[model samples]
Target: MKELQHLNKYFRKYRFKLLVGIIITMVARIFQLVMPSYVKKSIEVVEGYIGNNILKSEAKEMLLEYILIIVGAALLSGFFTFLMRQTIINVSRYIEYDLKNEVFDHYQLLSLNFYKKNRTGDLMNRISEDVNQVRLYGGPAIMYGIQTLTLFVCLVPLMFIKAPVLALYALLPLPILSVLIYQISKIIHKRSTIVQEFLSTLSTFTQESFSGISVIKAYALEPKVNAELNNLALDGKSKSMDLAKVNAWFFPLMILLIGISNIFVIYIGGKQYIDGEIASIGIIAEFILYVNMLTWPVAVVGWVTSIVQRAEASQKRINQFLQEEPNIVSTVKEETPIKGKIEFKNVTFTYEDTNITALNNISFTVNKGQTVAILGKTGSGKSTILDLIARLYDIDSGEILIDDVPIKELNLQSLRQSIGAVPQDAFLFSDTIKNNIKFGKENSTDEEIIAVAKKAVVHENIMGFNKQYETVLGERGITLSGGQKQRVSIARALLKDPQIYLFDDCLSAVDTETEEEILNQLKKESKNKTTLIVSHRVSSAKNADKIIVLENGKLIQEGTHEELNSVEGYYKELYMHQLSEKEK
Candidate 1:
């Protein structure tokens, strides 16, 4: 009931259709149950005719009337079945849309850490495959379950009317049948949970293999990957067989109970016929018809139970994801735009799963329009600082300010809008060069893309492509060189014309000459913008107005290049190491 309630929230919007379907199903079930009586009447008519109990003319008329009723009932049942099918299918599709939208909207509000700790393929599976399961089961379970109940409700009284003794004989199996279903449902619930988990793991494996195919190919691990995939498939197969075994037991048990009831009905009804206690022909035919009606509802018990249990398992996973809160929330108070002045005062942060701090008591200030360089070792908090500025996560203590206003006081969207970042690995979508450049600014014209591309020193390279601006790049811009993709990303950032620019080793992929040209262009273009660059290369950060060096999440040094070079520290060591490597 609790699981079904969760599903109802998604499906309630289509209640009208569901109600109409229920009505049609009930009408159909009436037509279906009424047919058995018509069959009985037709048999009686035949019996009377063969015995010469009625005139031949009267017998012919009675036979035709019964035949028409049987045919009409059958036709009505077919029509109602069609109506119920259409209603359920349409409602299912709409509910699928709603569930998918809700999942996506919830995902949008989730914390970045959630994505970092989760697998993309698993998330995709929940939103796509898992939601689909809920939809497939949600609509049909309600429709068919209602139909089964309605058919049983309408048939029970008719069974008594047809023959009270036979009805009592059939009712004996109902309790045991209920017990069998309850036990099977519990077993299915447990096993199906395991099945869903295995499927999520399988999705993760498939996703990782496809996304990292290059690495697999480079390392020649295809055979190992295949072996692991085979293991997953085997595990899935075993779980499925386990579920199958449960279903196998259920069907035979159900058949056994129904079969016993039918045998009793035959013995009792046959005795009534012999003793002339009841009308022989019509009563016997009605008993057979009622027994046939019982077959479907009883047989479908295992099937509907499986669908409901699987959907329940999927709902649990989806609900868990939806309940996750974003690590950073909007401050609620909307403030005007800050003046681009930035400061991090005694800020501290630690990732949830990590013992060591990623940033510790970090304090710094960059006045508006200042160009600052961040130099650090691989494990240092250079990128972490950039992420903090973007408010991807909340600070443990202290505050980050923009233009004397606490960042939390400003609207998150507005705060992020004022900033543009180009990470170390400049990611581009599977789009044309012009579209990639205009990503940050959707309204950017071709001329604007061209201008930004030139400023980023990528215009000539883009023109060299066969289709120039219109050439569709491969996924992540794989068709382009690393340097080209980086420059395109830089152009995208520049086109935004943001108040602050964060370049996190954006120039790492280009050659020295091209790097110098891009740096020169950025220096010219960023005259009035606050720029923060995280670079390992000495040439990239050599001319910054101020340089900040970090080691192990702590600031180790802060000065100009000349001042830093005179000091014996990490930056000087990094600079000398790069110089020595160049010399070698």
Candidate 2:
């Protein structure tokens, strides 16, 4: 109930439609009430003829007129019911569309850290399955629940009017049913939450296994992965059965309670009529019809209670996602174009839940047209530096500037658009080569794409395929070799033609000759653009205008190859080891 209260804002957005729907529901129910009243009149009309209140022919004519009124009320009730559904149900669908788009937009705003902490399949389930459950409650459950309430209120009083003793007798078991519904709803909500969480875990497990199926096959671990997946499926089934067990007990018990009410109306009302306390059989007959009307609403109360509980559980999960604040908030009021120059002034950063910093007191400057190479040992903070340049992660302390403007002060869209980065992973969507290169620059022409692909040295390989640039790649470009994927990633960046380009070990998969060829082409095209390369191999760093070497998160060396080689430090030590390995 509390979870639904939070959704009042969404309801308020379409309140007028909801109000009209409710009014129509009331009118339809009033017409329904007329049918039961006509049944009483039909019985009384025959009794009146026997008692001589009217002539026999007159009584027959009055009965025929009541019959027409009953039929007319029934038709009007159907029409109003249709109108109610058209207004209320359609609005629920519109709200569902808006809510989904809002959640997806929030996802786009979230930074890398959030993705690192959550699974893809878990998020997907929250958006798809959870939202759908909420829709069920918002639409049909709401309409039916209210209709039940209104019918209960209207029918019970009319029942009392026909036979006061029978109405009070029939209502004796209601308080008991209400108490049971409250208790059962609490348990149902708790169990439903557990079921939904298990569903999320199952979704995550399936997604991860499917994505890593190739690795499992290579390692010959299919049996183990399959066993784990089966266990999750079994667990999900067990919980569902548990919930089904609760429902099995709850729904039947509700029917039994309603049956008790009907039994009382028959036994007690029969005694009253025989004792001459009622005017005629019509009062008792009308009371029975009214009690039957109460039955449908009572049953619906139980059904909607279950729906409400499930919706509450789903709402709790979705609300948690909506509450998370996006790490990157763009607050820049003034926007300017980047000049490609970059400066890091005593920058420091540390990953979450860690004490050790990734970059400590790091300071460096790259002129607008310079090529800078970053060299470091494994876990020496090289890729972290490149990530900071594009604001993938924010720095803990100190300043990062682009063209004399603080990177933090620039709008995120313009900031990221100014830099073209190719990370070490080289992720490619499942699409054609032409579409992948044209991702960032959607309006890029065929001629522009060909030029960049040649600069990245991937044009020849693409031409070798049967479809050339139009050739479709599998997931993550699985059909392409490692070197091919890297070059394609580089080609994607080259097509952007951003002012600054950051490459993080992008050529590690290629041979030395191919790496040199790609690098040469990159240098030629990016002669006046800021280019930063993070590489492990000495060959990749030898020609950089400036080489910055890191060790233990500190800048221990900075200069060209000749200047660094003249000293006895980490750079020279790595250079000597490479030279001896080549000699061997």
Q: Who wins the TM-score comparison?
A: 1
What do the candidate models score in CA lDDT, each in turn? 0.85, 0.87
Candidate 1 per-residue lDDT over residues 398-501, each given as its tens digit:
78998888878878888888888898887888888888888889998888889999988988988888999999998778889999989999999999999999
Residue pairs with backbone overlap in model 2: none
lDDT of 2 by residue, 242-263 (tens): 8887777666876787788878
Stretches off by above 4 angstroms in model 2 are 46-68, 463-472, 572-584
lDDT of 1: 0.85
Cα-based lDDT at residue 543, candidate 1 = 89
Each candidate's TM vs. the true structure? 0.94, 0.92
